[model samples]
Target chain A: GESVGLHLPTLSVQEGDNSIINCAYSNSASDYFIWYKQESGKGPQFIIDIRSNMDKRQGQRVTVLLNKTVKHLSLQIAATQPGDSAVYFCAEGRDSNYQLIWGAGTKLIIKP
Target chain B: EADIYQTPRYLVIGTGKKITLECSQTMGHDKMYWYQQDPGMELHLIHYSYGVNSTEKGDLSSESTVSRIRTEHFPLTLESARPSHTSQYLCASSDFMGSRETQYFGPGTRLLVL
Candidate 1:
């Protein structure tokens, strides 16, 4: 059974500080990984993604790092702000049908 | 920001009642998906469609059925809703370019079966 899981259920960080959310995946065959942000009462929004061929990818102030050796994925948000307070999720995509295996979300809270 | 839309943002219905969740996308994406999520829980894929007239069941087993007669519209129908079906339903659409496929989601529908 393939599954994705988060290291922490909730993470608290101060504003203007960097935040790191970690995820672990069980499938070695998964080649694509994605990060999504879900605001309260809203659907998840795409943040960043990384392919197995690459080690890291950056988008705006967000960065995604993938370590295929350890089957780990991380999302780095620089200068965490109040707007960054949301639930973050990591998903792994297999070759078939492009369906993604989602993990339990990590709630990122920014302290004022 | 995605053009995807879901109707009946909040619904409260009795058990055994019929209900339908509407989902539509203006992006002309070839892929569409329906996901169920409980509060503070992981998302479970319930249904997905590759294109018009092509629908498939996802990883999770669901009692609801879906129809994709038009490219932009994909709706889910629950013939006999139950209390166990109470949850948030999200709709998403994606268009892949080569190996890059990103799903854009809509504001989910919150269903409460009383």
Candidate 2:
């Protein structure tokens, strides 16, 4: 089955430094991608998203880079903070589809 | 930031017990979804609804059922919960208008069947 997966199960970053999380998808027909953050004991929260037509999108302190040719996506967060400690998931979907293919998730840990 | 909410953040019940997980969204989105996830695992779609009085099964097969009586309310019911049914259930909604496909999620309900 086509699925989205993370490059690593966990990533550690120093406070005040930048952090990057990588994801790989197997479906080429997917036209939409999104990143979500889930805190402990909480549901997933929307972080950012990008369409296949665009290669990159930026938020307040986050940026999502999509590489359609390689089926890879990456999320970069600047100035990592303790509040940023959570599990991050990447999901892919088609523009006309209602459901998304979710990745297993990668835990982000902040070190002071 | 989203107005979606879920009741009974955590629950511990015995086997063969009937339970209902409540979910509601004030956004009045036309699309709603239910997903089951284990600790540190990926999400599995259990059910979803297109709108009021409209429902459909998701990719994963489950012993649970769902109902969408209004645009803001969607609930999931389990006839008889087993230990294997223990997991975190999440509810989400999205507006079908435009090219926005982002889903806003509720807090989620964690069930522990013993």
Candidate 1 — which residues are off by over 4 angstroms?
A: none
Q: Given the true complex, what DockQ would model 1 score? A: 0.78
How displaced is residue B7 in candidate 1, in Å?
Answer: 0.5
Chain B TM-scores per candidate, in order, are: 0.96, 0.95
Model 2 misses residue B8 by how many Å?
1.2
The residue pairs found clashing in candidate 1 are none
User: What is the docking quality class of candidate 1?
Assistant: medium
Task: Tell me how far the alpha carbon of residue A41 in candidate 2 is from the true structure, in angstroms, after superposition.
Answer: 1.7
The CA lDDT at B29 in model 1 is 91
Q: What is the lDDT of candidate 1?
A: 0.93
RMSD of 2: 1.1
Write the residue-wise lDDT of candidate 1 on B79-103 in tens digits.
Answer: 9999999999999999775576788
Q: What local lDDT score does residue A66 receive in model 1, on the 0 to 100 scale?
A: 89
lDDT of model 1 at position A83: 99
- Docking category for candidate 2? medium
How far off is residue A1 in model 1, in Å?
Answer: 0.6
